[model samples]
Target chain A: AQTVTQSQPEMSVQEAETVTLSCTYDTSESDYYLFWYKQPPSRQMILVIRQEAYKQQNATENRFSVNFQKAAKSFSLKISDSQLGDAAMYFCAYRSAPSGTYKYIFGTGTRLKVLA
Target chain B: DAGVTQSPTHLIKTRGQQVTLRCSPKSGHDTVSWYQQALGQGPQFIFQYYEEEERQRGNFPDRFSGHQFPNYSSELNVNALLLGDSALYLCASSLNSYEQYFGPGTRLTVT
Candidate 1:
């Protein structure tokens, strides 16, 4: 079974600063996908970024990027120049390859607060 | 294009009662998956449907079931509901089973 874990329950970042959220997972599969999703007070889940397990280079999208260490099974999200709008619950998820079940395994989530 | 959509944004049901939540996949998507998000927790996968058939399911019990229509719409049904069943139900759609687009979700409350 695959399990995602987020050690931080709450995090705060000053506006215009940067913050990093930590996430780790346990999986036996070699090839899979990792994702970060943000949910604001509106309760809408928005994709932040994604990283392929096989890709050594991390994935970056705008102000959000990931530090993926496949060997250690760690996938962390970094928010550069965090804004107030970045305040939300951030989730780290894992998706298996086609040969596997392909269901998403998500971590408990870390609530992000951007201090203005 | 419009993203995935869910009906009855909020619903309330008593214990032992049944509840059904509906979802419409995003345009051009053919696969739909359902998830349950308990308060303060990440969404948990319930099941996935493709080609109008169930392709995968999570660790949830048989009390939770679902169906997918020809138009790519789906329904999540829960019977003998308990207070523990109260949560936000989300629907996601994907093409080729890769990245998925999620709906706003339907909040279910079992009192």
Candidate 2:
């Protein structure tokens, strides 16, 4: 069984500043995928970024990037120049790659509050 | 292109009653997956459908059933619903195990 853990229940960051959300997962498989998703008050889940386990280089999508440490099994999301629109519930997810199951294992989520 | 779409943005049903939620996959997507998200919690995988057949399922009970049509659209049917079943039902679509695009979700309230 695989599990994802998001240590922060809530986080606050001033607008135009930076913040990092921590996430860790336990999995036996060597090949997998990690993702960060944001859900706003509108109830829509939006993909923020994704990282492949085999890729040593982290994944970056504009202001959002991930710090993936395969040995430590830690994948963190860093938001640079946070904006008010970035306020939402962020979830970390894991999925097996290649021939494994396609189901996603998600973390409890961290509610981000962007202060002005 | 339009993203995944779910029907009846909100639904209110009584306990012990049955409810069905519909989902239309994003254009060109052939795989549909369902998830249950409780208040303040992460989404839980319910099941996934491909080629009009169930390919994967989570720890949900048999009371939760689903079907995928030939068009790749899907429906989630929960029988004898309980208060615990109340949550946001999210439908996601992907192309061959790629990144899934999520729908706005159907908020099912069981009272």
Could you give the fnat of all candidates in order? Answer: 0.74, 0.85
Candidate 1 chain A weakest lDDT stretch, 10 residues: A96-105
Best by DockQ: 2
**Relative to the unseen true structure, what is the C-alpha lDDT of residue A3 in candidate 2, on a scale of 0 to 100?**
98
Compose the digit string of candidate 2's lDDT tens values, residues A1-116.
99999999999999999999999999998999999999999999999999999999999999999999999999999999999999999999999996649899999999999999
In CAPRI terms, model 1 is classed as: high
Clashing pairs in 2: none
DockQ of each: 0.81, 0.87
Worst 10 residues of 2 chain B by lDDT: B92-101
Candidate 1 C-alpha lDDT tens digits along B1-111: 889999999999999999999999999999999999999999999999999999999999999999999999999999999999999999999987888889999999999
Error of 1 at A11 (Å): 0.3
Local lDDT at A100 for model 2: 45
- Residue B2: error of model 1 in Å? 1.3
